[model samples]
Target chain A: MGTGYSIRRVERQDYEGVLQALSALTTVGSVSRTQFEETVDHWNHVKVSSEPEILQYHPYVVLHGEEVAATGMLFIERKLIHGCGLVGHIEDIAVSLHHQGKQLGRALIDHLTNLGLRHCYKVILDCDERNVRFYEKCGYSRAGVEMQRR
Target chain B: MGTGYSIRRVERQDYEGVLQALSALTTVGSVSRTQFEETVDHWNHVKVSSEPEILQYHPYVVLHGEEVAATGMLFIERKLIHGCGLVGHIEDIAVSLHHQGKQLGRALIDHLTNLGLRHCYKVILDCDERNVRFYEKCGYSRAGVEMQRR
Candidate 1:
């Protein structure tokens, strides 16, 4: 029940906090500072334009008193067919274990989905079955099959 | 068997041929010349570098006697977890009806997968059950469940 918790685009200084928050979602090992910088630099470069929504790779973080409690990324992809020119793919969503019940995950998803709706015909994401109901409650209905390489 | 038939990166001049080949994959409506030009320009901008691999969006076409008979696109994505940094996503694969039995699809898949292996720990693609067997034969085995929004 903390106040002044806001969600915003990640900044350079937020890398460490963001990484710490992401570790709870998976085994985040020793990622070099250079790698982190490179990833953020690439993301910043991609988001330079607003007209071409696909150019913007938005990575948002939930800040509770300047501490990154959660993070998510939305990448825009341009589609060539189906009259769907732009699409949004959501990935890298994670909420720190301590901040789990604060609804930060839902907030991040809503924020990304809102951005997607403004610029893309569809915003899609793939998740494990366990997380399917959560996304369904967020307005995403069951769609097609998802297969991956072994 | 045309002597000049080969697979190569799509050149600016291959627009018309590429369009012709892509039409067979789906009911491609009247895509304006400007749209085609813009797409090629976008692809060119994305592939300005090769070191990162993720920045190089490869669009390849199979040329059969000065005509583009098949086309495919490979887009690289970077992952932050799972010890995997870069992942290759295959998309927009199409072959002209006349070129169906020539194994062009396999050729395109192999070319992209090989490039992926060099810069990425793993390459993955999503396909309907109908096309899973084809990809399995290309060395991609069934792995995880794919669930998406409707």
Candidate 2:
């Protein structure tokens, strides 16, 4: 009725804040802050690099009132095969805990898909069997059989 | 002289092979291919996702005579802080048991590092303290203390 939230790209400075916020998010349930921070750090390194080649393939984040509310990647593959030799990955979609149910997650994913379309290729993402419904809601189908040997 | 050794980026199809090769590099020496394949599937999902607010990074491998000899990530990050902000990471660096010589590891790190320097604000990675020399030789200096809550 009053103001609809906005979706934006995440920036570099948001790393620590997001990590801290995730620590808080997990505090609501599962992991401890220390454990969560490690995951966040691992994610950070994967996203940002001291050297840059594949960096150009990555994209930015979205901010709601100056706070990062959602994030994802517009992943691209330069190698041949898998649809005209170029493909996109829909990666690391996260929504702020307090911001759940606002459709911010949907909007963020839609934005990523549109970006992929702009590049003219397929946009793909894999989810835990637990998240199949959430991704289905986001317009992604069960594309293939993916297994993790961890 | 015989055919001189060389360096190059990994082909996409080469991944599944390396995924299987990881068993030989495990801390305990080897793991079951069945167990190894599962983790590879998981990491594949992680690397392929790049939705709205998140960054997704991946690994690159070095080849010697059609075999993977060394591996690391071609990481990237956005505007990040040095002491505070963090960017990308280079992870899972392993040299094949049979190809330890020929400077394959050094060549792989050099290639991936250059890729990161071009795009992101910083490139960072973590390894067990025992790997200090391995990373140091690759030009990584250790300073900050890293603790994981997980």
Candidate 3:
């Protein structure tokens, strides 16, 4: 099915949508129901309190006619040492299965890229090995081997 | 002056130290004080209140005697679809000017890397163009040309 979507920063009222997406994402990733609910609640509280503009710094989800299909985060950028350093990073990205075949994934990325440029961030994110093609299609070429050891 | 130094995981009480670092870094990048403090506070609280099992996920500064000279973070990784994706990303990092020369930065990074491994998380981070050399020295080689427009 073709996906119809609109994405924007999440407001406090959108917390339920964020929760719903997390609940539906039984997508082979490691997650704890308790922790997921806790994280979602924390995000929602941050939006409601507005004590800190922290909510503005992260990414939100996509609404497919009232459904949360995907989610991502943007590390609100800042130039360091007088623009001689890297600024922002985008991470924690996911698009739901139904919307995967559609262009929403690339679109969300494009939206973030434009947003990053508008804000003038220096460095951006590089995808993991598995998602390289997905990001490449979004014009995100590899920066280098993202080596991780645990 | 010799750059006396130290490194350790962050504590909730060290909230002020992290805030001071963020304040000193105002010109380093585009960041607002109120918004940033809130974000820092969130990290502090999580580190303080996280479950012991999860506490392995937080990294902090190594004080050169009594000051918060450097900082780092740890993550618990997993490849969960629609979950955390089981990877850890290090963000909002900094070092004190007085401690730049010493290998405190490398030590801090290594410490977090070790921590990540312990928690089964694959640690990853993005470095600015200027600090690429710095991270390289820490054993985090370039992944590729990380370019972000927005």
**Best by DockQ, which number?**
1
Q: Give stretches of model 2 more than 4 Å off.
A: A1-4, A21-55, A82-84, B1-150
lDDT of candidate 1 over B1-150, digit per residue (tens):
346679888777886788778888765556666776666667667641256435556788898988898999877666566543666777778998778888889989989889777776677766676888888899886543444432
Cα lDDT tens digits, model 3, A1-150, are 254677876554554455455444444445566655555454443321242233324566788887777776655422223422334567556676666667766777777666655544454676646667767777666554443343
Ranking by lDDT: 1, 3, 2
The candidate that wins on lDDT is 1
Q: What is candidate 1's DockQ?
A: 0.42
Whole-model lDDT values for every prediction = 0.74, 0.50, 0.55
Cα error of candidate 1 at position B47, Å: 5.0
lDDT of 2 by residue, B9-127 (tens): 44445654565344355432343444344333433444422333343445666665676666655444332123223245454466767667667777776676666655444566555
- Residue by residue across B67-136, what tens digits does model 3's lDDT show? 8776656533223244444456565567666666677667777777766655553567766567777676
Better candidate number, 1 or 3, judged by lDDT: 1
The number of the candidate with the highest TM-score is 1
lDDT, candidate 3, at A102: 74
